[model samples]
Each structure stands twice: as structure tokens, then as C-alpha cells.
Target: MGVDFDWVILGILAAFIAYSLLTKAVDRSLLTLPIIFMGVGYLVSDPLRAAAPPEILSEGKRLLAEFTLVLVLFADASHVRFSQLKQNWQLPGRMLLIGLPLSLIFGTLAVYLISPEGGIAMALLTAALLSPTDAALGQAVVSSPDVPERLSETINVESGLNDGLVLPVVLLGAILASAGVSDANTDGLAIAALIQIVLGPLAGIAVGWSVARLLDLAQTRQLIAESAEGVVFVATAFAAYVFAEVIGGNGFIAAFVGGMVFGNTYRHHIRFIREFMDGAGQLLTMTSFLVFGALLLPDGIEHATASAVIIAVLFLTVVRMAAIWLSLLGTGLKIKEKLFLGWFGPRGLASILFTLIIMDEYVFANADELLACVSMTVAFSILAHGLSSTPLARRIGKT
Candidate 1:
């Protein structure tokens, strides 16, 4: 079969690149990359969308989402400041330990109330899927000089680690639900989850440690080139992810663990490496958002009830904020600061990727509902978070 879709992909990429360039030309604008890319993707796909195969679009979206996430996860985790983490452990500690679990609970409750059609298993799956935050979605806040370093650092660390930590829950939920879900059987999911959660970190440690040692050796021997130094970090990240998945481990966890280990061990090399991959990941993120807009948004809106949309808005506002309030009770942060932290837990890449795994597994029971909820929540997030980030940053930065 002669595939012409390659041309379509290239065209979309080129157009977005140009759009991004033009956006960069105009300074101090509310137009975010996600909004622009999403609008374009939606516009183009609206015409010729049905001409594309569902599987192909779905698979392509999943791959793009996966690549974006793996890169971002590694980059985010590797940049964590251990010294700061040591000092400010109370902040991130409260977030990951308390805030994360509460968010999971809130997600479950939200799903249960909003999507009454989905089974308990499905509710659990959706909850697990949305439990983790996406730092990439709020990159402005994290990367900005204006934002308080402590707050951004805490959020970044939470985003970097929570997704990996929640990996097993997402898998286990999917597995338990598989029995009644179309042709899926719940035979090996538990074992799969166990192996993945355990082995992913082991693989990451091996890859990250070995690469750090190798980089050091190369530096001592003067074997490193200017351009190729970046490759070492990139290669290590891809290696950790691919190796873990090849061995049936959780690649995302492997990448996250690998990034964390690499950053902590070889702190010197990571800044340059992160800079290189951050740019690449941004491009990938743009494309992922575009693809999501074109395909997933339409599907989400179609399948979603007005009630589901309302629940999604509520999920973004009340559910996450409440989780933050509870988690930060004793942190001594001002009410405004707590609210700032709460409002910024924007969901993006990881949630979408987790939801897509359901489709990849051909999950059949209330799959539509699950997909709808995931899509609606994420789409709402990309818009709401993207829009609010700048003004909120200005407001919070002043404090």
C-alpha cells in the first residue's frame, strides 16, 4: 500500500513550525503554543479526518504522546536540585506523599460521579490516568524567572515523579477491568504490573549509572565532542526507556528513574543535556497537542455529555485545589500561595498517554466513556491552564 499520509504529517509539521516562528515574532501575547497548534490541527483535520484510518491516527497519536512524555519525564526529573530537595523536602514531600494520593481519590470520586456509566474498574482506571500532573503543561510557571523558585521547583518535582510512581496503579486498574472489557482478559496484568514497576527502576539505574560513568570517562580521555556530548544524555534516556520496555518493564518509570539518578549523580552534565532535550521535547509537545486537538477533541466532544464537561471543569478547579489545600495544611504557605500551587496542577501528556493505552489494549467496556473523560479533561486543561498561566504567574510572582 502506498502511504500518502507521510506528506500530511510533514505538511502539518511545517505549518506549525511557521506558526511557532510567527508567534515568536510577536512578543507579549496571550496566544500559547498549545492553543495555536491545537486550533490548526483541529482545522486541518476537520476536513480530511475521516479519510485517515482510525487505528493509524490513534497509533500515531499514541506514539507522539509517548515520545513527548518520555523525553519530558527524563528532562524534568534530571533537573531536580537535590540540595533544594533536601532542604525543601517538606513541600514536595507533602505534595507527592499526601497531595498525590488525595488527587487520586478525588479523581476516583469525580469519575464515579461524572461518569456513572463506567464500572468501578473504569472509574479506577480514569482516576489513575488523571492522578499525575503534567509539568510540561505549565512550563511557563516552572521555567519562568518570575515565578517563585520554591513553588515551581515543588510542582516540577511532583510532575516529574508522580507519573512514574502512579504507573503501577494505572496498569493494575486496567488489568482488573480487562476481564469484562471486550476481548481483554485479566490473566497476566498483575504479574505484568509487578515486573514493570520493579524492573523499570532497575533498568533506569543501570543505564543512568553506566552512562554517567561513561561520560566522566569520556571527559577524562578528551573523547567527547561538542555536539556529541548532547547525544550521550539523549542516548541514555532512550536506552533506559527502550531497555526497560524490551524487558517488559515500565519504560516511563525507567526514564523517570534514569533521569533522577543521572541528575543526582552527574549534576554537572545535566544542565546542558536538559537544555538540548527541552527544545526537542517542546517541538514534540507542540505536535502532540496539535494531534490531540485535531482528533481527540472532536471525539471527546462527541462522546461527552454536558454533565461530563461540567465534571471536567470541576475536576480542573475544585478537585485539584481541594487536594492541594489538604496537602499543604501545615506548610505555612499563605492562602494565596496555596491556592496558586493548587490551581497550577495542569494535566497534560501523561494523562493522555495513559488513556491511550486503554485504546491500544482494545479496552471495550465503557472505553468510550473513559476516553471521553480523559480527552475532555485534558482539552479543558490545555485551554484553561494555557490561558491562566501568564496572568497567574504575574500575580503570584509579585507576591
Candidate 2:
């Protein structure tokens, strides 16, 4: 049966609607839907005697992953409350300052020792890619009213900010790995990276604040319609991204900063915008997982050596848990709170995006190994953390 473009679109839409309805009746495991859809994609793509060709699926997977990440980064940042962040600054402060760097160091060392084939540069790149936690991966913990609000907020804030935080490290590492660290242009590239990091958020704040003020003025003058508010929110996010990039800033950082500033400045407008984007973000996220299943998983698994797989598993489990434990040291959170936060630092969307960005750079001669490490780690996290998030949160809640 030949399928037209409209038919294909309609089929996907119907499948998603049916999947959504089914999820209502099931236990709603985090990895469950992703695993299911991935299986579906795999089965469809597999011929009796041969695998589906890469050319058939690679572009679609890449585009879906990128779009999902853009929406997810914006939505996650938009949910942050600057006031709340200020009041409960200790947890996030320690996590970013101490926990993050420690995690990167530990992860790099772990990768280095475990994957001797992947040298220090590849090891460090893998570490940077996996260091940032995926907030959406552990939604049950962060979103739960039962979880200690401080702990929950800290994780949420950390996840929202860290992806942007790690961008400079990743970029610097890429440049160093691609061009020897001692190259003459390294200093210039470092300066450029610093500018991107600093100016990205600054541009975002300016554009976001201006847009928020304009929207408020329009609302006061009764010049804006309720129906058009959603469009305005998206336009503001896109403008932040475009303007930041035009000036050599990180567009992802701008999206996040734009969302944060907009969230703070237009508190009343956020609920509507967030609700609209939340649905869209979830859909994009699901599509990302499906693509992961169909494209990255099989290829990553096939390319992954024993050492790479071992490192990926260890990073998701021991390395992450250890970093969380140490990071929470001076915060005075209860052991239970600390442990829950530690184990739940699941890597997800951000890792995937970082992998894509690095893949584009063609930095590592061992790009295949690097991509394999990243893909395996992220895939494992989607299963391991997703399965455990709900039960673990409930257990901690009881304590």
C-alpha cells in the first residue's frame, strides 16, 4: 500500500491520539510509552532479511530531536520562578558550583579508565554531554506536591539551567579536541565562547523583557486578543533565539533566558502560554524518543564496544549518584532527600541535543565512539530512570 504525505501525517496523528488514550489506562511508566513507540518504529522499519537503510530515517530523527530539544529547553526554563530561585538558592548554588564540576571530573575519569580506546578528549566530551540532568525525565519527583518543595525546586532549577551552563564547556572541549589545545587560535575561540555564553542570556533578558512589556501594554490598551496570545509567546521565543544567534550568542541559551525573563515579567500570561507549550513540548519529546528507538539505538548499540557500554552504565548509576551525594554535602538536606535527588538525576533530552551539536562539529576523530557512548548512556537513562522515578518518589515521600 502506497501512502501519501497526508495519509502518513494522519496515521501519525491517529497513532499518537490512540497512544495518549491508552496511557490513561496503563500504569504510566516514564519509559513505557517511549519503549513501546520505539518497538513500533523498529518493527515497521525492519525487513525480514535486512534493516531499514539509514538514509531513510536519519534526517527525520535529527530534525525531530532538534525541535523537541528547542521546545523542551524553553518550556523548562519558563517554569522557573526567579523569586523562588533566589529564596532557595543554596541547593542550586551548591549543585552548580560543586556538584556539576565534580560530576564532570568524575564522569571524565570514569570514561577514560573504562574506555581506553576513547582517550581523554573523547572521555571529557562524553562527560560534558552527560553531566547535565534532564528535568523532564524525572517529572514525577520534581512535579510532585509530596516531595519537599525545596528539593524538588532545586532539581527543577538545576535541570533547566545546567544544559545552558554546560554549553561553554562542551564548545571549549570540542575546539580543543578538534584543534590541539595549544593552537594559536584557541584563545580567540575561548573568548568567542565566553561571549556566546554571556551575551546569549543578556540578549534573551532584553528581548524577553521588551516583549513582556509590549504585551502588557497591548493588553492594557485592549489591542491584543486572547486567541493571539499563544502566537505571541512563540514569536517572542523565536525572536530571542534568532536575535541571539545573529549576534553570535547561543540560541538555546537565549530561548531559556527569554522564557525565564518572560515568565518572571508576565506571570499572569504564563499559565496560558505554558499550558499551550507544555502539550507541544511533550509531543516533541515523545517524537524524540521514537526517533531514538528507530535510528540511534540500533546504530549506537552495534557500534558500542564493551568498554563504552560499561562506561555508559556506570555513569548513569554510580558516577551520577556519587556526584549528587557529594554535592548535597553542606546543604543539610536529609539523607533521604539527598539520595532521592541523587538517584533521580536522569540524563535525557539535553544530552541528545549536545550529542547532535558535537556530531556536527566533527571534532573527535573518534566521532563514532563518542556518539555511541552518548547514545547508549541516554538510552539507558530513559529506561533506568523512567522506570524508577515514580516508585522512588513515592518511597521517599513516605519517609
Among these predictions, the greatest TM-score belongs to: 1
Q: How do the residues 97-160 of candidate 1 rate in per-residue lDDT, one tens digit apiece?
A: 9988888888788777776677677777778887788876677788778889988888888887
**Model-by-model lDDT, in order?**
0.79, 0.75
- TM-score for model 1? 0.92
Q: Tell me how far the alpha carbon of residue 327 in candidate 1 is from the true structure, in angstroms, after superposition.
A: 0.5
TM-scores, each model vs. reference: 0.92, 0.88
Q: Candidate 1, residue 159: CA error in Å?
A: 2.0
Candidate 2 segments whose C-alpha is farther than 4 A from its true place: 1-14, 27-31, 45-57, 180-192
Best by lDDT: 1
Instruction: Give the least accurate 10-residue stretch of model 2, judged by summed lDDT.
Output: 44-53
Task: Return the clash pairs for model 1, or none.
Answer: none
Residue 218, model 1: lDDT of: 77
